[model samples]
Target: MFITKSINTFGSYLMLMGKVFARPERMRSFFKQYTKEMSQLGVDSIGIVLLISFFIGAVICIQIKLNIQTPWMPRFVTGYTTREIMLLEFSSSIMCLILAGKVGSNIASELGTMRVTQQIDALEIMGVNSANFLILPKIAALVTMIPFLVTFSIAAGIIGAYATGWFANVINPEDLTYGLQYSFTEWFVWCGIIKSLFFAFIIASVSSFYGYTVEGGSIEVGKSSTNAVVHSSILILFSDLILTQLLTE
Candidate 1:
């Protein structure tokens, strides 16, 4: 039974991907949905991202300074460290983890509630393709917005680092500026952007899958929401590790 269930789940995933790619009509609807989700995922999340990024940058910069004491501890190392952490891990991996908790759970619960209320079945009867209509837009929106969000996150993190350097007096303002200027690299930025796109897909698809497959009553909806967040978070972490290995090596 367990093996059979696993196969069925895997088959469902393949079918979902196939449907997403093969149907032109569905793609149009998905695009429309994407616009709506963009507002929710990108615009709505800006404040939180800003707040988190600021503190993260400051804390990381301070911590790095505290740990290193050699004359060879280049002033530019601060900026390089910030850029490396933000580009490789913070913007992509950590943001997804936050989204999995906030956005993923929300998507699952909303869809699950619709399912329990028979709204999903109503859509089906009305000839609406639930996956294409509901899920696709979210996927599209995430793919489109995550890179932009990462950019904001990177900027905010840098500002935070600057604030810490100025306030703590561990590094001179000119030195911090020099570090930031010296560490700037296009490849690191590109890697972060790519990771953001991948994370967007993972969060949207996983959340939508849980929501679409929801059954039972309100209780089940709650369970599905929890599952969606937990599972999506795990997948994001695993994918980050894989991508890091591939990209860094």
Candidate 2:
């Protein structure tokens, strides 16, 4: 039953996506909405992403320094491990999950409230492409913003590791820099961007779907918001694994 339900939701979500991209009735209005969403979704999101990423990187460095048993193990291994983990996994996956809760819930609740308040009905009454007007801006904003956030996260994580290591006397500056630059692959950055794009799409689309399709009152709107976060997080995790496998090959 769960599988069937998921499949149905997936199909409906894709249909909704099609509507989201339909040609806008007024390009100027669409552009205005897009700009607003870009600010709300992207610029507003930087602080939290940076804060979490910096701390995680700092903690990882401290933990790495504490973990090695062998005196022979290079101290710089901390840099490599921290870099790989932050860039490949934490920044893309964990950050997106955080966003799934923060931005996702907000998106769902905002739309859900609009639905429950008959704002959506009013739009349709005016023959507006409500989905396009409401959802496209969000989708466009996220796609543009998430990759930028992930890139910023990677940089912030490395800086955090550097600062923590330097101040805590856990690892030397030379080793940290060497470790990050060691065996670095340009492809890793590409992979991170790819994951961020997919995650951005999933978070926005899933949240919007719940918000747009909500069926009832304030209580139902709240439930839809909860469902949006829960489902988007699950999908982000599941898709991360699939992306890792595919991208590695």
Candidate 3:
């Protein structure tokens, strides 16, 4: 029964995507929506990303210095490890998981509310391709802006690592700098950006699916929002594993 239900849901999701990708009736309206989503979904998220990444970077550096570092281990290892973790996982996968809660829930609730309030139905009554009109801009905005988020996350994390050296005295600034620059592969950064793009799509599309398909009252809208966050988080993790393997190899 679980497998059957899963397959059915997947089929429905794919069918919805078919409608979502249809050509927009008015390019002007689509562009306007695209700009709005970019602001609402992407730009507004910058503060949280920077704040969280900074703290996580500091914590990761401190943890390594306290627990992982030893007499034999190089001091630069703390910075190097922090860099690798941020570039390879945190900025891309973990950050997206965090976003799945914030952004995903937002998307789901907005759509679910529309569903319950008959707003989407009203659009359909006006002969609008409601799915495309409503969802495509969000998908595009998220995909376009995720790379910038990943980049900002990396910078904030690195600065946080340095902050620990300045204020916390946990690690040497010189050693941390050396470690961050040590054996740096530019591809690791690109890998993170690439992974984030896919994660963004999963968050937007999956959340939109739950919201757009909602079939009940306000209570059901809440349920769909929760489901959107949970499902998007799961998909982000699963895809992260696959993407890491594919990109690294």
Q: Which candidate has the highest lDDT of all?
A: 3
Q: What number of clashing residue pairs does each candidate have, in the order they appear?
A: 1, 0, 0
lDDT for each residue of candidate 3 in 1-249, tens digit (9 for 90 to 100): 999999999999999999999999999999999999999999999999999999999999999989999999888899999999999999999999999998999999999999989999999999999999999999999999999999999999999999999999999999999999999999999999999999999999999999999998989999999999999999999998899999999
Segments of candidate 1 deviating more than 4 angstroms: 1-5, 22-31, 69-72
lDDT for 148 in candidate 2 is: 91
* Pick by TM-score: 1 or 2, better one: 2
lDDT (0 to 1) per candidate: 0.81, 0.92, 0.96
Candidates' TM-scores? Answer: 0.91, 0.96, 0.99
Q: What is the lDDT of residue 83 in candidate 2?
A: 95
Tens digits of per-residue lDDT, candidate 1, 8-57, equal: 97788668766655454555666666778999877888888888998898
Weakest ten-residue segment in model 2 by summed lDDT: 67-76
Ranking by lDDT: 3, 2, 1
Candidate 2, 46-92: lDDT as tens digits: 99999999989988988887875247987668899999999889899
- Displacement of residue 49 (Cα, Å) in model 2 is 0.5
Model 1 residue 76 lDDT?
74
Model 3: per-residue Cα lDDT at residue 202: 100
